[model samples]
Target: MDVQIVHEIFFMASLIFFGGMVGGAIAQKFELPDVVLYLLVGILLGPYGMNVLNVANGSLTVKLILTVGTSFILYLGGREVKIRVIKRVWVTIFLLSTIGVLISTFIVGYTSHLLLGIPFSIALLLGAIISPTDPATLVPIFKQYKIKKKVAQTVSSESAFNDAVGSVLFFTFLNVITSGHLSLEHSFVLFLKDTSFGIGIGLLIGIFGTVLISQSDYGFLKNFSPIMSIFVAITSYLVAESLGGSGFMASFVSGMVCGNKVYIGMKCNLENRKVQETVNETTGLILRMMIFIVLGTMIDFNIIFNHFWINLFIIFIFMFVARPLTIFTSTLPDGRADWHWNEMLFMCWVRETGVMPAALTGMLMGMNIPYLSHIVGIAFMTIIITLLVQATTTNIVADKLGLIDK
Candidate 1:
C-alpha cells in the first residue's frame, strides 16, 4: 500500500471515531439508538454526500475492515449468550434461526418477484441477503433498554446463529442464479456441512481457550486472558472459513463457550468480566461506526431515485408483512418457543438489518450479479429505513410491552 493511502486510512479512522462519539451523545439525548445517528453522519460525510471521506466502495481497505469488524461483532454476540438462557430458549432460537429465516426469505423473494417483475433468482438473492437480523445493531438497543433476559437471549442468539444460516442460503441461491439450476438436496447438504463444521471448529477452539485460561498460573497470564480470548475468537473464525465452514458461526460459538466458561467449569472472575466488558464496549462501538459509515458511502443516490417506489414497497412488505408472518408462524407451534403474545409481537418488530446484510451486499456487488445496482440500492435503503424506523421506536415498543427492566 502507498504511504499516502495508509495515512488517509488513519485520517479516515480518526474522523469516524470522532463522529461516532458525537453521534452517540446526540442519539442518547434524543432517546434513539446511536446506530441511526452514526449512519446518518456517514451518509452526510461520505463520498455521495459531501465527499469529505472518499473511501472507494470496492477498496481493499474497506473490505478488510468490514471483514474484521464483522468477525468481532459475531464473537461479541456469541459471548453474550449464556448457557442457561440458551437451554431455556434453545428450541425457539433453533426454529427462528433456521425455519424463520427461510420463511422470511421465500415470502419476501416470491412477493417481491411478483410485484416488481424481477426474476425469482434475483429476488431470492435479495431475500437471503436481508434475511438475518444484525446483532451488532440490536445488542446496543437491548443494553440501552435493559430488555428482559429471555427476550434479549432469544434475539441475540437468533441473530448470531441465523447470520450463518443467511450466509449459506445467500450463497446457495447465488449459485442457483449463476448456474441456472436449483437442487434441494444439494443445498441442504451444503448447509448442513457448513453449519456443522463451523460449530465443530468453534467448540474445539472454545474448549482449548477455556482450558488455557483455567491453567494460567501467573497473575500476568490471568490479566492477559482477555487478549488471549480475542486471539481465539479471530483465529476460530479465520480457521473455520479456511476449512470451508461458516466463520460467523465459528466465531459465535467460540465466544459463547469462552463467555460461559464452560470448559473451565466456573463463573468468570472480575478481571475476566472486565475484559469481556471492555472488549465488547470498545471493539463493537468502533467497528459499527466504521462499517455503517462505509455502508453509507456505498449508497448511490441515482439508484435510490430510480427505484424509489419499489424500494419503499419492498421495505414495507419485509418489515410489516413478511417479518410478522415469519415470527408468528415459526413460533406458533406449541413447545417451539416460550414467547407470550407481547414477547412475540416485540420480537416481530425487532428485525433491523445491519452488518451482515451490508457486508454481503458489498460482496454481491463485486460478483457482478444481475440487478447488482438495484440490489445494493435496495439493501442500503433497507438498512437505513430499518435502523431509522425500528431502531428508533424499539425502546418505546419495549416499554409499552413492559419488556424493559424497571
Candidate 2:
C-alpha cells in the first residue's frame, strides 16, 4: 500500500467518526434520518465542498470502505428480522423480496430504454442497479420512528433479502451485458445454488453462535455473549461467500438467529441482552456513518449533471410508479397476512436507495462498465432524492397511513 493512501485511510476514517457523531446529534435534534445528514456532512467535507476529503471515486480506498460498511449494515438489518414475526408474514416477505424485485427491474428498465434510448440490456442494468431498497437507510429510520411492528419488520426484512437477490441479479446481468453470452437456465441455477448456500451457511453458523452463548453446560462463550453475535455475523458472511453463496444473506440470517436467541435455544438474560444491544447499536451507527458519508463524498456532480433532469424524472417514476406497482403486486396476493391499504401504501414510500446501490455502483465503476457516467449519475440521484423525500418524510407517511405505533 502507498504511504499517502495509508495516511488517507486513517484521515478519512477519523473524519467519518467525528463528523458522523456530530451529524448524528443534529439528526436527532431536528428529527431527520441520520443517513441524510451523514451524506450532507460528507458532501461538505469532500471535493465539492471543502475539497479536503478528495479521494478518487472508484479507488481501492472507497471500495474498501464500502465492503466493510455494507456487510455490517446487512448484519444489523438482519437483526431487525424477528423469526416469530417472520413466521406470520413470511409469504408476503418472500414475494416482496424475490418477485417484487423482478417486477421493479423490468418496470424501471423498460421505462429507461423507452425514454433514454438505451438498449434494453443496459437499461435493465439500471433497473437491477436500483432494484433493492436500502436496508442501511430503512433499518435506522424504522428504528427511530416506531411504526406498526409488522410493517416495520416486513420492510426491513424485505430490504435485507432483496439486497442479496438484487446483488445476484446485478452480476447475472453483468455477465450477459459484458460477455454477451446470456443463459436463463444458468442464471436460474446460479441464483438457486447461491441463495441456498447462503441460507444454509447463515442458519448453520447462527445456530452455532446461539449454542455457544447459551446457558447450557456446553455454552462456553457465554461470558463473551456480547461479541459472539459479531463473530457469527462476520464469520457467516465470509464463509458463505467463500463457498459461492450470498454473503448478504449469510450476515442477515446470522443476525436474525442471534437477535432472537430464544428461537435458537439461547437464554436472553437481561445483562446479556443489554450488552448485545449496546454493541449492535454503536457498531450500526458508525457503519451507517461511514457508508453514506463515503457515498456522498464519491458523488461526482459532473457525471450526475449529464442527464440531470431526465434522471430526476426516472427516479420519480421509480419511487412513485414502479415501487407502488411492486408493493401491490407482491403484498396484495398474500392472503396470510391481513393486509391494509394504508400499510401497503406506507411500504411504497419507504423504499429508499442507499448503501447497496452505492456499493454496486462502486463495483460497476471499478469494472469500467459502459454508460458509467449515466448509470452512476442516475444512481446517485436516486440515493439523494429517495433519502430526501422518502426517508425525511417517514414519520409523516407512517402517521398519515395510521401505521405509527401508539
Candidate 3:
C-alpha cells in the first residue's frame, strides 16, 4: 500500500513485460519453451540474481499477484479442453487422474523413502505434491508437436484433472500428519466430499458464466471475455474450498465447461470464423509470454544447487521411468498399440510442474514440515528440466518418430 511499494511493483512489472518479449524471441529462436525464458528472466532480475524484484521473502503483494496469476493460468488450461475429447477419453482420464496418480505417488514416495532416508509419511506427501504434471507446460508442448489428438488428449486431460487429485492427496496426507485424529476412513470420506462438491460448484459457476457471456447485450463485455474468465476461476475456486471441496478441481472443471460450452461449442457461433481464432490465438500467445517470464523471474538458484544431485536423479527417473510406465501401462488396454516405439517414448516424458507445487512447498515449510525444502527444490528443478528440455525437444522427437501431423 505504500507509494514506494507501488513504484516498485510498477517497475518490476515493466521489467517483466520487456523481459518477456525478449525471452519469447529467444525461446522461438532456440526452439525453447517460452516458460523457461520467463523463469530465466525472473531468476536474473528477481532477488536471486540482480535484485531488481524483491518477491523473495514472500510479501503479501507478491502472494496475491501469484495467486491471481495461477488461477487464471489454470482456468485457461481448462478452457483448452473440449467436451468431445472428454467423452471419448473420460475413462482414461479418470483412471489416470485418480488411480494413476495414486500409483505414482506411492512409487515415488517409496523410492524416496528408500533412497533419501525420509519418513514414510513425509515421503508420501512429497510424492503426492509432485505427482501431477503442470498443464501450462504440457498444453504447449502437445500443441507444438502436433501429436495425434488422442495422445495429446490423454496427456492434456490427465494433467488438467490430476492436479486436483494431487492437491487432494497432498492435503489429505497433511491433515493426517498434522492433525491429531485422522483415520483412513475419514480421509476417504473427505476425498469424496471434496471431489464431488468441487465439481458440482464448478459446474454451476461455469453454467452461469457461460450463460451470462452467451446472452450479454453489451459489446464491451465480449472484448473483455478474458478478464471475466479470471473472476469466474477465482469465485469457483474459493466457493468450492469454502464448502469443503477441492478448489483446484472445481476451478479446472468449471473452466472446462465454460470454454467448451460457451467458447468452443454452440454459443460460439463465430468460432469457425477467422477473427475469433485470431483473437484466441493472440490471447494465448500473450498469456504464455507473461506467465513464462514471471516464472523465470521467480526461480531461486540457491535452492537448485542445494539439492542438485538428488533432485536431478528424481527428475531424470520420473521422466524416463515413472511417467512412461504410467502412460504405457494405462494406455495399452485402451487400444493404443498402433503407436510407434519412438512415439510411445515421446509420450512417456511429458511431465511438468509450476506455481501450485512450489507454493505448497512453502506452505508445508511454514508448518514446520520436514522435506518441504527438498520438495520445492525438486519442483523447481523438474519445471526447469521438463519445460526447457522436454518441451523443446518433444517436437524433434515426434518428427524423428514420424508422429508429426501431416
Top-scoring candidate (TM-score): 2
Worst 10 residues of 1 by lDDT: 214-223
TM-score of 2: 0.95
Residue 91 of model 1, lDDT score: 77
Across residues 1-406, which tens digit of lDDT does each residue of candidate 2 receive?
Answer: 5898788788988888888999999999999988999999989999899977776777877777776677777877777788888888999999988889999899888988888887887888889889999888887777778888999999999998888788778867876788776678877777787788888998899888888878877688877877886788888988998998877778877777777877656785678778888988888777778888888788889988887888888888888898998899888888889889998989988899898898888878667577777888888999988898889999998998898788
How many angstroms is residue 113 displaced in model 1 relative to the true structure, after the best TM-score fit?
Answer: 1.9
- Candidate 3 wrong stretches, greater than 4 Å: 180-182, 215-224, 262-266, 269-298, 336-342, 362-365
Clashes by residue pair, model 3: 38-292, 38-293, 38-296, 39-295, 39-296, 40-296, 42-296, 42-297, 43-296, 43-297
**Local accuracy of candidate 1 as per-residue lDDT tens digits, 1-406:** 6898779988998888888889888988987888888888888888767788777766787778777788878888887778776787787788888888998899788877887777887898899999999988888888888999888888988888888779778877877778777778877777787788889999998777766666344233555676766787789988998998888778888888877884347444576768757866787788888888778777888887777897788889888888888787767773645579999999999999999998888776566677787778778888988888888898899889999988
CA lDDT, candidate 3, residue 67: 54
**What is the alpha-carbon lDDT of model 2 when measured against the actual structure?**
0.84
Cα lDDT tens digits, model 3, 1-406, are: 6898789878877887798889878977886777777778877877767877655435555455555555655676777777676676676677778878887888778877877787887788888877887777777767765777866776787787788788778878887778745577987887788889988998998877766555445332454455557678899988988988888778888778867874454354353223434554565566555555555656667877885887788767766777877776666666523545665576676666665565455445436677666766776787777767777777777777776788
Worst 10 residues of 3 by lDDT: 268-277
- lDDT of candidate model 1 versus the reference: 0.82
**How many clashes in each candidate?**
0, 0, 10
Better of 1 and 2 by lDDT: 2
lDDT order of candidates, top first: 2, 1, 3
